[model samples]
Target: MYNRIILKLSGEALAGEKSGVNFDNDVIKAIVGQIKKIVSNGTEVALVIGGGNFWRGRSADSKMDRCKADQIGMLATVMNAIYVADFLNQDGVEAVVQTPFKCGTMTEEFSKASALNHLKNGRVVIFAGGLGHPMFSTDTITALRGAELEADALFFAKNVDGVYDSDPNENPNAKKIDEIKCEDIIKNNLKVIDLTAASLCFEQKIPVVIFGLNEENSIVRAVGGQKLGTIVTV
Candidate 1:
């Protein structure tokens, strides 16, 4: 459980009940509805979401240079941020979408001071665009943002239920870990979080919650102190 937290959502989760490369209003509204419950309970929130639903740079780089694809991925994240910010506004929650990379029309430039000011004002901040650089995933951004915000915990909402010894979908008998130390995670080379992200949390001692986004009430369960997922701590 955490007081103030950073939530990392993958883009595919925003796709709603269809298979496509576009934004879904109903899905956004549903996410906002869930978040409202937490904010009403006086929790400070920040988020970092990926853009895999629209475009995953690596997957599209058949002819494009790696750097170009990564830049395209960053832009995709900015697009998601704009959509999220607009949806939050419609939900009556003051949300600020900030990016480490400059996207004047979509969001403000990211700065810890500005983000803090917004949080102090009870505004939910959506950090997007993955540290304004290429080659790093949003997971890395989540860990860095967690440290910068001094968040009690980082919630990673993935498609899987929790950290497994192997891909749960691929390996039906993969062991799900309820709790584990960060060092062991690295030593075992578990992909629960990337090495960079895990190293940051390991150094900072911030707990990371890995849970399935598809699970009903999973986000609330994590925020409500329910031990329903794999927790990585050191």
Candidate 2:
């Protein structure tokens, strides 16, 4: 079992399969339940949530400034982090939201030392704002935080169950790789994560577990050393 881990949750997963919604209550509840169980089991957990549910800067109109669009995306993630933190707290799990930029008292500014302290004290740390810069994904933020906190592994709670040779939605023959190396993922352009995030994980030698959040107790199972998802080795 992992002593500590950084979990990356995409906004799309929070939004669920339904459109025209900011969050799916059932999905969030299930995720929070799993987290509570893990925390009870003595695993230190930190989260990095993506903003794709509210906005995708890269998908914005060409007329809009890229940096401005990304700023909006960052705010979206802050919303997600805050919501998740509150939900976890309501469910009896202590959680704190931290960001790279100030939220005017809405959240605390992120620091490696403070975040580590929070984890050490059994508080779940939620990281938002994606490195406080444009053109960077939350995946990179996950890698960065995992390295900084010296987590045992990085957990990718994604829409897909695991990494595939091709887009599984488009290609019926796409094969899921049970285990893979970060270097090969970068070399093959697997699209499992952005190049920057993969490079950082490789450099830091951080292991990653990629799994579908919809699966029953997926996060708990992954952290428990169950082989239910793709394992990405550094």
What TM-score quantifies how close candidate 2 is to the native fold? 0.97
List all candidate RMSDs to the true structure: 1.4, 1.0
The residue-by-residue lDDT of candidate 1 on 123-144, one tens digit each, is: 8899988977778989999999
User: Candidate 2 residues 40-68, lDDT tens each?
Assistant: 99999999999888888758687899889
Best by TM-score: 2
Q: If scored against the real structure, what TM-score would every candidate get?
A: 0.95, 0.97
- Candidate 2 regions exceeding 4 Å error are 58-60
Whole-model alpha-carbon lDDT for candidate 1? 0.85
Displacement of residue 210 (Cα, Å) in model 1 is 0.6
